[model samples]
Target: MTEQQDIQLTFEEIVCACDNNIDWVVSVIEEEIISVHGKPQQASYSGFQLSRIRRAHRISRDFEASVPATALILQLLDELETLRKGG
Candidate 1:
């Protein structure tokens, strides 16, 4: 099987991708909904993480969900996907 490389995005790029402010990204990081590499101010995220960020932002915006709630929702979704993959 061929291997695929995950794209990494900087803090600023992540914020731009979500079209939100830095505070939002920081809050997600603080909540541990997503993780990063490198220094705090210079953190970088994988493309997979970027998908999580976008999902969390949409869930929060569309349902007015709290960060913690969004985190739980994302976890459940992750589990479901894993099951679908028979893992």
Candidate 2:
């Protein structure tokens, strides 16, 4: 498979493992604004998108920023992934 295809497949796997409410997942992706190559970008996430969202939530919480519950959901999703990975 091509590299892009591999990435897409991997991302889908992550989303499935996320186990979050699908509607909330979609909202988080829609609301999140990210920078790619110094340009602002938006993402359309599948279930795997939760991994990145969760990471962002952790960083924000560590900095003591009050992220909303939807954001916190990502944090929980990440923790679940870590446990599943046995790391």
The residue-by-residue lDDT of candidate 1 on 4-87, one tens digit each, is 988978788889876757887788888889976655469768888888899999998898888888888888998999999999
C-alpha local distance difference test of each model: 0.84, 0.46
- Model 2 residue-pair collision total: 3
Q: What's the TM for model 1?
A: 0.81
lDDT of 2 at 77: 67
Candidate 2 per-residue C-alpha lDDT over 2-79 given as tens digits, one digit per residue, 9 for 90 to 100: 654323323344334435334433444555522122211233333334446566545554665434554666557668
The global Cα lDDT (0 to 1) of model 1 is 0.84
Best by TM-score: 1
Model 2 residue 53 CA deviation (Å) reads: 2.3
